[model samples]
Target: MLPVVLPLPLYAADASNTMVVSAAPAASGLSELDTPAAVSVVSGDDMRQAAPRVNLSENLSSVPGLQIENRQNYAQDLQLSVRGFGSRSTFGVRGIRIYVDGIPATMPDGQGQTSNVDIGSIDHIEVLRGPFSALYGNSSGGVINIDTQTGQQPTTLEAGTWFGSYGSWRNSLKVSGATGDGTHAGDVNYTVSTSRFTTHGYRDHSGAEKNLANAKLGVRLDDASTLTLLFNSVHVKADDPGGLTPDMWRADPHQVASNVSIYNARKTVDQTQAGLHYVRQMGENDDLSVMMYAGIRETTQYQSLPASSQSSAAHPGGVIDLTRHYQGIDTRWTHRDTLFSIPVSFTGGVDYETMMERRKGYLNFSNNGTSTDYGVMGDMRRNERNLMWNLDPYLQTSWQLTNKLSLDAGLRYSSVYFDSNDYYITTGNGDDSGSTSYHRWLPAAALKYAFDDSWNAYLSAGRGFETPTINELAYRSGGVSGLNINLKPATSDTIELGTKKRIGNGLISAAVFQTDTQNEIVTDTSSNGRSTYKNAGQTRRRGLELGLDQQFAYDWRLKAAWTLLDARYRTNACGTANCDGNRIPGIARSMAYAGLEYAPEQGWYGGAEIRYMSDIAANDANSVKAPAYSITSLNTGYKWLLSNWTLDMFGRVDNLFDRNYIGSVIVNESNSRYYEPAPGRNYSVGLTVTYAFQ
Candidate 1:
């Protein structure tokens, strides 16, 4: 295993705040909210204390109703599902929208897939659950908004390093401060960082490596206005061991094959994002913010297939390359005032985006003629272009019926349009072309009542819709009819009731929700061994979520959450009706998390956390189930403050018990008969130090 090197000169020790003005009580509290949805915020301080080793998905595993499945590789295997909405996908994120500083991170073609984010620069994350299409068009499941750190404090210098098991190591440094030296504080704040990560991977032929760089600059125009520029980039190189079949796992979970004939798969991805945000106060009672962003992302991936069931005489061993580009713009406005003694607020926004993508397949032949040899010729080429546009308008009002009672109501409407052009070609064969389009409407409403500062309750309902992604539509060949352009958009309706209560210094929250979806997309393998995508029948999911956060007078704190879900196919005309009543594939019926922490004024702190997930069915047939698993982690840190410098040290132990389990499962692409496991237990740790000048 190669030594893991943390990109140095990119780490910082000074902590930053993560509070956003949008979520302030005076801006839009629970009683004044406009949408029928659930939202939660994870502060930057909280994320720093947690110190996750990987990306956003790993850091958010504790969020209620969220499931993150890490496939251990950098590409095509990371799976993130919310409320069982994105489990059927093969690569990249789907069924949810991800935004950074209000810029759409997901592509325009309904494919919410991308890995351009730099978690180290993020200051806060806001998770909005249920159908929020009325707020963000064309998405039915949920929304993730990431806010990065800006110029909030004076100049400072920071750096850090991390070392742990599996030859892992990471180093970073950062500097940020005011540009002016005197009382005239009209200066800009800037931050730049870079990091490299590597791991020997648990299995043979699975080691991976990555490099990332990010920067941000913020200029304060006035007390009520600011402008900021952002940039981020990442490069990755990794080996693919290929997922193991269910039978292989049961026979020998630790066994890994290393073949001399297997060609090493390699991939490289580059992403650059640039955006400008302007915030201005329209008046004392209203405010408006506008942001424009443009991003370009490119990727090249090569894969060598062994003599698997996917290989054939007509289609021997081969390699494939994929590439893509995306661009978009977004804007929003907020207005608030009193009408007839009742508080009223209005919000509206519009977004436009375009995307272009292409794929090429190559074949190589060996003297032995084994299915594992890469043939010596190009087999196919595919190209696609997609365009999308959305508009949303919403209104919310609240009235205080009495000193202790309040009423809240809201409404929103969303419209979306999607169009795509696809083309395919085979060696010496002519090109085949096709085009398709889809449209949808979504709405949401909510009612909330607050008894006092310590207690609140609410009921909400909303509609959501999702169009088929480009990948599901463009990867078909001869015997395989590619691109289901005629497929209809999937639709969902959800209703939820919840309450939040605070007693003493402790907080408790609970919610129950039910969602019914139609036109769910399903991928099925035919007798010819090619996978086909189609819209399936209806499916229902209902669940309850409970969470508790408490702090003791002695500096001890406890946080915990539990979820119970009932998901099943309600109707299926595809002869798979028996899937009814079965637990949803890729979802655990029950999951729980608990954490204990101790932080005192003395500058020393530590914490321990445990997460548990119940067994999950690998497929709709319910013939196979991935066993339940639990993982424990511990972290500790100490800080020392002086007149000119601040020193700190921190470390953590993941998979404390070293339990073996599969992070995710999927049906084999070549054979309709089996499933594959992701990875097992692993560990990592790191530390940070800083210096400052006033």
Candidate 2:
């Protein structure tokens, strides 16, 4: 369960009607109220005002059926899960689809990173969870769509600054404008922003710095066609404080683990990406859309490893350097018409994506007899080039069965290929080069019925497929060499039933879902700080999600969310017949959140939020656990207008009671250093100034 607290401001452009376009990977043009799948949309202004506007984990608390945990470690990114599906990821996002302005933030190899998202310039966020998500292809446990802010009629220039706890500060500037009148072929609008942030972190030996730039440009080529371009870049440098053992955490929660400073564990990344979207209306009942994007990312990371490990031919070294180039394109056609006096719509699309990486590893020591500089690059030890690609074609349709009922269906065929070439094979090292491919035919269907003007219900079902990511296949168990070629893709069947109701000035929603998986993937073994994977016989996941939004009066509003999930392995595997009937390693069984706000159309506004989560298993065996915890936070802000300029001031406090708890855990960690501590009693203040010009 999750809870969110934010003012009910009329900042949303369409506050009365929730219209969603391209909410899915194949551009499902449907209203939120009419969609059969479980979907939710969060207003950008509400999110920015709710917290410090730093990470997605700050504002996702109000979304039902989703879980996001902040590790307080920028190098690790956020731990995100939809229902209980994506909880096994050790790094980055898995089993989910992430997109920004029609461009995929996830790679073809089923890995994703949200560090490049420009939170301050976001217009809205759409989350889709349930069976229908399988139409997106491999690893589609869920989907997240983020749309950036666009230029309006009046040009605006804005500047902002923020100062927060733990020696953190950020400065940002933005410019938006339009050229010519609002006429075809003459109208062009653009929005550009840049920001820099630095933080000393709450724990010892942990600090991070980030710089970002984002831009979006839109042009109306004609009355029936439009073109949009998006550009984004990010550079980050962060130090890993490392997880702590129970004893270490008990002594000092804010202290770094042993060897953290000695090893100088750190990571650096630079990424730049650009995308173009084109839409054309062919006729009164036909339309076409296309999107193309390309990006490059370079990263270098230093890890903690003993010198003896580096001397072994089987060891992959400690210092990792990677350069990746990725590109993709998607095209779709939509048609609308009437069949026998009944309304019907159809969409067909094709997607293709490719990525190539040059990965290398080196010793972290100088290798000058006894000379040692833990983070410096030394002799090269391992080198590999890897490539991944995917192709998917899909078709979707919606039929108005009657005045109060509708039917939606979709089918997609996905094919993924992986290839690798190892170039640093030596005496005891074998040619670890290998290639693998996977294919699947996914289908989904849903039925929606409107009981009345205030009540609606839906039922949906689908099949999902997930393949091992490149990182998961990189290393094998028992210190074996070569790729994990024996690993196979996982498949599952899912079903969901949900209902939505409008009561007075509030809306309520509830959903129950179940999934059964075959050849389920699970951690096989952990040795020498390295982890491997194996297929289990079967697994089951079921959950319930509930949400509420209400407006009590002119100045008061309430929002709440709760979730109950049960995920477990159903059969024996992992070299132990007793492994059957064990709870999943990463997810909790129960969660809840609630928030209230007051905002009387203007002046000052304030709110508070409360969140709670139950204990979580740390491994497949369920021997170790992370205890349940609760947190509270409060925030307030004021907005005033002067002449043609507007000013805003805000402040916030997190963990008001200063609770000491583990914010996140590294599931199946080899060394028992599983706990990542959250900061206690943090504060932040910020100000923004904006001016409008002709």
Candidate 3:
């Protein structure tokens, strides 16, 4: 799709637009074009312009095949999925590998949360969405790598504030600097930032508040070694409005579900983490790198469950208090050499991670020998200490077989272990403790053929596996006791064919992929407000994605993306005799997005976007559905640069048409309170000022 037009200087390679896939690389490394995978990069400057810069969904709408929905209830986090892989998660992220800087954000059990991400200081985000992502180990349906901003020449201080509808406000401050000159061992750079955000929320009792801080320091040593240290902390308190039934949603979308106020349904989290990275050049053909990180997270949550359910000795109570300590280290060695007289590079590494948790549960009420207060702590129902760990050794290599052809391959051996100790035991609740372990050998391969400088084609295939998360195994169905130790892991084999084409001043890409899954984990039963899971026979998911980015004259740009997915159960699900061919729930079948922006060096700049998502099934049986909807938004801003100071003012309006829609859903809720409504109309405004000094 070549246009008869000359390329402008704006499309040329520059620091701002030079895209790279830092996550998928050999010892010598390779650029995005040379990686032979479906990868995309979104620059920070583009994300910061006329945006809230708060959530990942706000800036990632242009990336095809990624579905993100704002649940409005921050306590539950956002609902995100890549190629229908993680759509079933009720909280946090599943089936994806997330990393910030050089540290792992996903836990050893493959559960991840983005509440700690410092979006204000992000420099760029890289998304890898194909078979190649299997190299990252467990639950890697996709990989997301976020890189924070580095200090520039001349120290700079920035302060910003934003105000939005629903009584929402955000304030932030940042400082960064660099010292010394070129190649010197004493050279250093540092960046520090902090922010506070609060929201009244669109629905009743859904308010939330958060405080976050991040810091990074880098030092060069002896011109052959470098060290970087990173630290981050976050505290959050939020009210869970809970989900609404279809009748309740139709009556009043802004109302909280029943019994939420009585139980004070809420959640609180505090976390602090730090990491260190070291790199050194060995000889002329070898390099070594090492990374170590540790973190602590504390959480306390209250749920709305009836007292009758707690009367059963098997119940785990409605109040949960958990403290988790996690740490990990990774080391790698790379050798740049020739294989059979052909240019080749190889990298081998091992990663070890472990986590321990002190978990306790208590009833939500006390009898007090009189009337019961619904929110007071009554009796301890459960007390347990649990541990989980994983170890993996991986090797990757890339070879240039010919001038226009290349081959890349990798292998990894993964092992995961879990164990728990029960402390609270009585006649009714006997010793209900157990241990389990899982292991797998994962492999990936890809072949790339370059038709010319402007076009490239590739085919890749891989095998992936996902073990049962700790939370998923904590409880069993039918009000049974102890953990579901009989659960099995899910395995998948995927294949994809993709092509990338460079137009005059833009790029176009498309991919077709298919995956077959065995022993797919799914919800088995939801009784007494507790959920459990079991393995399904088999499942299938196939999808197509298309993306385009074009820049025209006069600083105007157009960005668009579209995705079509067909996911279904190929065999009996939920232990049914023959409920095969049912559509998988919680994921939209078709999605589309488009945006247009016009920005110049000076004067006013503005943009508008349109997004659409098709209807979705809400359960494994496909008995209920959520209607499809479309939304439109507009954003505008102005910038002024005078002397050593820069000033920017921006405003945005979401749901410009004020269309009523379901923003997200809780898949297969036992209580049938599945709908989470979107706000009708909303507005936000912000101002940023930066000063540069020596």
Best by lDDT: 3
For 504-606, candidate 2 gives per-residue lDDT tens digits of: 7777899999999988777888664456888887999999999987889868889899999999989886475486889988898988999998866457989
* Residue-by-residue lDDT tens digits, candidate 3, 176-207: 98887525898998899999999999999999
Regions of candidate 2 where Cα sits further than 4 Å from its true position: 1-31, 180-183
For candidate 1, write residues 258-349 as lDDT tens digits. Answer: 32125555556667777776666676655566667776666655454453533453332245555666656555555555657544544455
lDDT (Cα atoms) of all candidates against the true structure: 0.61, 0.82, 0.82
Clash pairs, model 2 backbone: 1-591, 3-593
**Candidate 3, after superposition: displacement of residue 237 in Å?**
0.3
**TM-scores, each model vs. reference:** 0.86, 0.95, 0.95
Residue 188, candidate 1: alpha-carbon lDDT: 81
What TM-score would you give candidate 1 relative to the actual structure? 0.86
Q: What 10-residue stretch in candidate 2 is worst by lDDT?
A: 1-10
In candidate 2, position 646 carries an lDDT of 83
